[model samples]
Target: MDVKNKVVIVTGAGSGIGKAIAIHFAKHGAKVVVSDINLESAQKVVDEIVTNFGEALPIKANVAVFKEVENLVQHTVANFGKLDVIVNNAGIGPHLLRTHESTLRDWDRVISVNQTGVFYCMKVALQQFLEQGYGNIVNIASLAGLKASPNNISYSASKFAVVGMTKSAAMEYATKNIRINAVCPGYTESALLTQLINAKPEMDAILKSVIPMKRYGKAEEIADAVVWLASENTKFITGQTITLDGGTSL
Candidate 1:
């Protein structure tokens, strides 16, 4: 809600959407906890936030790991003395293969990071919320979650799972003052998208053509949606998936 002194943890704060979300939340008066697998990268975002007079803490955590996720929440609560919001944005969509061509390892990695990782992050956050009687969770899904991306089966499935998880969690906690929602982003010019575009030009064009807006969505635009959803602006909202997908799902 009112984020002035609220403590917020954002996973995958190393770069791209996560970095943008972390920066925006900090700029908007939230005390942000910047976490990523890479400590240096997380620190960079934290540095910028603090340099600009916002408060932040850089913590290296692998959200896919339960213990790490638990400690992450524990440390954030310890540092800020209260928990208000958690953005489970740490995910990987590296599977660029057809279903039959995909390996179990690829599927496992994508599912673990994109789907199960969100579960772990929220589990810890939910525990604290149950104890304190309030909390908000915003998950980063993908446009692929709402539609099929034939080649990237694992990625799409992972995101779809996130969407389902978001809804279920939201409904379960709605009466308990906990809100859970998801933001589904379309193709953005992140390193992951750039790599995919470079590898398959025609496929990239096909992907863009699906978006009625005819262009890639900006990371900042998605960040704006996330901050608003996490802010006091949408306190009554829960069990919702905010699509920042440039009309791709339509």
Candidate 2:
């Protein structure tokens, strides 16, 4: 699992799971690119890394936009001299609503950031990987992707697309030494989860009761899995979705 000296990029690294991933990668000696739409937030993460004597660079990017995604990859390579791995951790959750109640505006926003954003990141990263002959990608999906997520049509749809895209891209680049994989987390303790719980207070108990573990996952736990997937130890693993839920899908 040694990732020392590798140049890695983590999108939406300003907070939550992305923040943990960026910090964890840096702790393992990877040169991290902390990317987020909010430049201030991204810089804060970078500051934390620098304070701990870890290497990091802050770059603001909106994954939904192609030009920004392109610049993110370009800027990372320009600063680091090479790109080794990219973690597509940027995503947005939609309001909990059934398909009939969902608005086109909400659906588009979710798809743009959660689905198309992953595509843009992967496309740009794959281009760089092809030139370098080897690279790794880890996408942060959701448990709703594999199982039915009632009342959250947009989020579920976008995450399912991520899972499919991860496998498809992995197969396409398998022989090229490019590895692609995704992690589907369930009811993690993040701002997104908090928002959901706040929207429907009953969801707090409802979610935990379904999980065999009777608890929510931590951001660091997800980060650890991501680091392992991106490391050499999992070099043979690709096109797989690792569910990090506490037996909720079971």
Highest TM-score model number: 2
Candidate with best lDDT: 2
Candidate 2 accuracy as lDDT: 0.96
Q: Model 1, residue 201: what's the lDDT?
A: 74
Off by over 4 Å in 1: none
Native-referenced Cα lDDT, model 1:
0.90
Kindly list the per-residue Cα lDDT of model 2 for residues 1-250, writing each as its tens digit. 6999999999999999999999999999999999999999999999999999999999999999999999999999999889999999999989888899999999999999999999999999999999999999999999999999999999999999999999999999999999999999998999899999999999899999999999999999999999999999998999999999999999
C-alpha local distance difference test of each model: 0.90, 0.96
Please provide TM-scores, in order, for all candidate models, with all chains considered together: 0.97, 0.99
Q: What clash pairs does model 2 have?
A: none
Predicted structure 1: clash tally: 0
Off by over 4 Å in 2: none
